[model samples]
Target: MPFTVYEHGAVAGWDVARPLRPGRSAGISLAGFRYRSAGSADLPVIPHPAVTVVVEFGDGSLVMGDASGWQQRGSLVAGLVPGAVRVRGENVTCVEVHVSPVVAHAVLGICPAELDRTVVALDDLWGRDAARLREQLGDAPSWEDRFTLTDALFSHRRGTGPPADPEVVRAWDRIIVSRGSVRVEDLAAEVGWSRRRLWSRFRSQVGLPPKRATTLVRFRHAAHRLTAGDSTARVAAECGYADQSHLHRETLAFTGVTPAALAADPGLAVDDIAWASTAPTETA
Candidate 1:
C-alpha cells in the first residue's frame, strides 16, 4: 500500500502517513502521523462516534485536556468526549486507530460509555503490555510495519474480549447506514426489542444510550461535510438538523466552533488524505 502524506497546517513540520489498505478487524482502521515544530501545536479532538487510540513515539510530550490545561499521557485511548479537547505537542510520531463503538467493547475491552467524556492512558487499561508494544513500534523500521504490528495487537486482544450483542451490532449498522437519520424506536422495532430494552442494552454494551449516540453520529456526518467544504445550509439540511441554527448549536456543542470556523479549520483540511472510514476491512 502507498502512503499519502499531508501537511499539518501552520505547524512547522506536519505530515500524515495514510495506510494503503484497511485493517483486518471489523470497524477498525489505522493512520500513521509525524509532526515536528519549534513551537508547540494543537489538534482539535472533535466529537465523533469512534473511540480513538493514539500510540506515540516522539521527544515531545502530548497533552489531552480542555481549555484549562492538560495532563501528560503516554498513549491515548479516548472515548466520547463531550466538549472540545486539544492534543498539544511537538516532534510527535504516532499511529492512530479509530475503533467504532459497535466493536469497541470487543476491541478495547470495555463499553465506550464507561470512559465517555474522558481520556485514559493505555498503560492503565492494558498494563505492561502497552509499554512493550510501544517499544516494539518505536523500533519498527517503517510506518507500514508499525501499522501491521498495531493491527495484529488489536486483533489478538479483540478475540479475547466479549463481543457486543448481535442485535446491538445490527442497530449500530442501521444508524450508520442512515447517517443517524433513523429513529431509536424504529431501530428497536427492527431488532424485535422494546425501546427501553434497546436503550439499556445499547448503553451497557456499545457506550452511549441510543438517542445520544444518534445525535453524535448525525453531528459527525455534518462535521465531515463541513470539513470537506460543504456549505452550512447544505450540511444542516442533509444531516437531519431542523435548521441552520440547529446545526450551529450542535456544532458548538461538539466542536466548540461555529460552522464556518470549523469548516475553515486547517487540521481537518488534511482528513481526506489521512482519515480512513470506520467501516471494516473485509467489507470495505
Candidate 2:
C-alpha cells in the first residue's frame, strides 16, 4: 500500500501518524531501478517551529532539497530541526515525522541539542539492523508502541526528559481548541486550578510559558493556510490574529523570516515547515 499522511490529536498542534509507502506509491529510484510516484503533505511552512526526520527503508534512496544551500537525499536523515520545509519527491517508501516540542519531548524524550538545521544520514543507526524497527511497526500495535518507536528513533539524543504533568497536557489541549483566543484564567479555571498553578505546570511540561505555547499554536494554524497559498491577511483573520500586520510581525518574530518569504520558498526556512500528518491508527 502507498504511504498516507494521517492527522491525529485533538490539540491544535499538528501531529501526523504516517505509514510506509509502497514502492509504487512513491516513485523511487534505487540502484538503477526507477519507481515513479508522488508523495503526500501534512502541513505548510508556518511561523511556529518544528523538527522533521526522514527515514528510508531497504535500499530506498531519498532526495530532498530547497532553494537555499541546504539539501540532501539519503537512505536516512534525522536531525533536521525546526524550519520551513518544502518536501517533494518520488519513491519515498519510508516515513516522515513532524513533531511539536511538547509531543517531541514526550515521544523522543529529548530535543535536538545542537539545533541541526541540515540534513545528515543515519544509515549507521539502522545499518544492518532494520528488523527491530520493522517489528515495531507490526500488527496489534497500541499507543505505547507508537510512542516506543518514536522514542527509539529520536529520544536517545540529549537535552530533555520524560513527559511533564498530565494536567499540563490537559491545559495544552484547551489552549489548542481555543486557538489562542481564550484567557489564561479561563484555562486555569477549566482545569480547576489557579492561574499560577496552571502556568507552572505548562512551564514544567512544555518548557515554555502558556502564552508562548498559545502563540505557537496560533502560528501553526496560520502556517497551514500559508502553505496552502493563502494571503497573510486571510490567514491572520482566520487564525484569530489581530490583523494581517499582527500576523506578519508575529511570524517574523518567531521564524526570523517574512510570511511571504516562507510561502514563496518553504525549503529555506527550517523552523516553519509542517512535517507530519494525523493518519495511520486507522490503517493499522
Candidate 3:
C-alpha cells in the first residue's frame, strides 16, 4: 500500500496508509497510521457513523479521553456518536478499522448497543485476542501486511458471528442511501414493520434508535461538506437541513463545536486520504 505523509497542520509527521485493495467484507474499511517522531500528538476525534477500533502497538501509549477528563489507554473501541473525545499519544502506530453498524456486531463480537457511545479497552470486548492482534500487527513487516491481517480477522469474525436482522440491515441501508432523509415510517413500511417495531429492533441491533441514527448520518454528510470548505449555508441547504441554524444546532449537539470550528478540525482534515473511497454518509 502507498503511504501519504502529512507534514503540516494537524497530522504533521504522520504517515497514513490505506489498503491497496478493498476489504473482503462490505461496510468495513481500514486505515493504517504510523507517527514517525517520538513527540506527543493530541487531536480531537470527530464523531462518525461507524464503530471505531484502534489496534495500537508501538509504545502502547495511545490515550483516548472525553470532555469529562475520563481517559483510556492502549487499543480501544469507540462506538457510534462517542461525543467530544480526543486521542493523544507518542510514537503511535496502529491499524484503525471502521465497521458499519449494520455489520459491527458480527465483526466486533458484541452488539453496538453494548458499547453505547463509550470508549472501552479492546481487551474488554475481545479479551486476549486483542492483545494477540496487537502483537501480530507490531511484528508485521509492512503496513500492507498489517492491513491484510486486520481485514482477515474482521472477515473471519463476521463470517462466524451472528448476523444482524435483515429488517434492521434494510433500514440502515435506507438511512445511508437516503442520506438519512428518509422517514422512519417509510423505512418501516418498506420493511413491512411497524414504526414501533422498527424502532425497537433497530435500536437493539444497530445501537441507536432510527431517529438518532438518521441524525448521525445526516450530520456526518454535512460535516464532510463543511470540511471540504463548503459554506455552512450551502451545506445546510444541500444536505437537507432546514437552514444554517439547524445545521449549527445539530453540529453543536453532536460535536460540541460550531460549524466553523468543526470545519477546521484536524481529525476531519485527513478523511480524504484515509477514507477516500467511503461515502460521506457511511463509515468514518
Candidate 4:
C-alpha cells in the first residue's frame, strides 16, 4: 500500500466538509460540518488535549452534553471533556475549532481549569460577544467567510489576554513532540521547575496535572493508533503501556469502550472527514 498523509481521524455528517483553509497558527484549526438528517440519540464525543469550540448555524440545533442527560444548546466551548456526549441535530452547519491547550487560555480568555472537562455554552464565556459571533457567522456568505470572521475575532480576542506561561507552553510542546512519551519529571527538570511547581502551574494553566496530562496525551496517541487500525498489542507496545491489559484498562477508562469497539465507531469513522489536515472537504 502507498503511504499517504494519514495522520488520524475525525467526524462529518451529510454534506459535511473540511474548513475552507487551515488556521495559520500552530495552535488552531477549523472544520466545517453539515448533516442533513437528525440523530435520535446523542452521538458520543471523545476528548483530546485540545479544547474545542463548535459554532452551529442552519435549520435545527443540537446539544453537546454528557450521558447523565446533561446538555446545553447554542454554540459549545469545552475543555478536555471526558466520556461520551450526544450530538443530535437536523440540517446542521457548523465550524468546529480545535484549540491547543497551550494557547486555549489566551484564545478563550479563561483557564481550562474553569471548564473542567465539561461543556458550556459559548455564549456564557463571551456573553454578548458570543451573540455577535453567531450573528456574523450565520449571515456570512460562505464557509470561508465565516472562517475568516472567526479567525479575526479569535485573533483580536487572543491579543487582549496575557500570553500563557512560557515554561508551560514549552512543556506542552515537548509532550506533543514526544508523542506523549516523555517523562514528567524530565519535563519539570527541563522547565527548571520542581515537581510541585510544575504540577501547580501545569494544572492551573493547561487544565490537567502533569501526570494526567501525560496520560491523556498518551491515550490520545493510542486512540488514534487504534482508529488507524493497529492491533491492541502493537498500539500498547508502541504507546508505552506495560502490556496489552494495561492498554485495555486505560483505553476503556477513557473511551467507555473496548479498543475493538472504539476502532469501529461510526462516529469516529467519519472523524477523518472533519480533521484530516491536508484534505479539502469532499462533497457528495
User: Which candidate number has the best TM-score?
Assistant: 3
* Number of backbone-clashing residue pairs for each candidate, in the order shown: 0, 29, 0, 8
lDDT tens readout by residue for model 3, 1-284: 23333221225556677776788989998888777766787777877789999999855479998778899998999989888778889888888899999898888888899888788889988888888888888777777678889888888788445788999999999999988899999999999999999999999988999999999999988988998899999999999999999999999888778999988876677654577654222112
The CA lDDT at 84 in model 2 is 48
Query: How much lDDT does candidate 2 score?
Result: 0.51
Q: Write the candidate numbers in order of decreasing TM-score.
A: 3, 1, 4, 2
Candidate 1 local Cα displacement, residue 179, angstroms: 0.7
List the global CA lDDT of all models.
0.78, 0.51, 0.83, 0.75
TM-scores of the models, in the order given: 0.90, 0.53, 0.91, 0.88
| CA error at residue 192 for candidate 2, angstroms | 2.5
Rank the candidate models, highest lDDT first. Answer: 3, 1, 4, 2
What TM-score does prediction 4 earn?
Answer: 0.88
Tens digit of lDDT per residue, candidate 4, span 119-224? 8888888888888887887777666677788888887778544567999999988988887888999999999999899989899888898888888889888878
Name the better of 1 and 4 by TM-score. 1
Model 1 agreement with the true structure over 1-284: per-residue lDDT tens digits: 23233322222256666555667897887877777557776777777678888898745577777886756466878886546877777767788888988788787877787887878888888887788888887777766678889989998888556788899999999988888899998999999999999999998877789888889889878888987778999999888999999999988888788989887876665444467354322111
Residue 47, model 1: Cα distance from true site in angstroms = 1.6
Note each model's CA RMSD in angstroms.
Answer: 4.2, 9.7, 4.2, 5.2
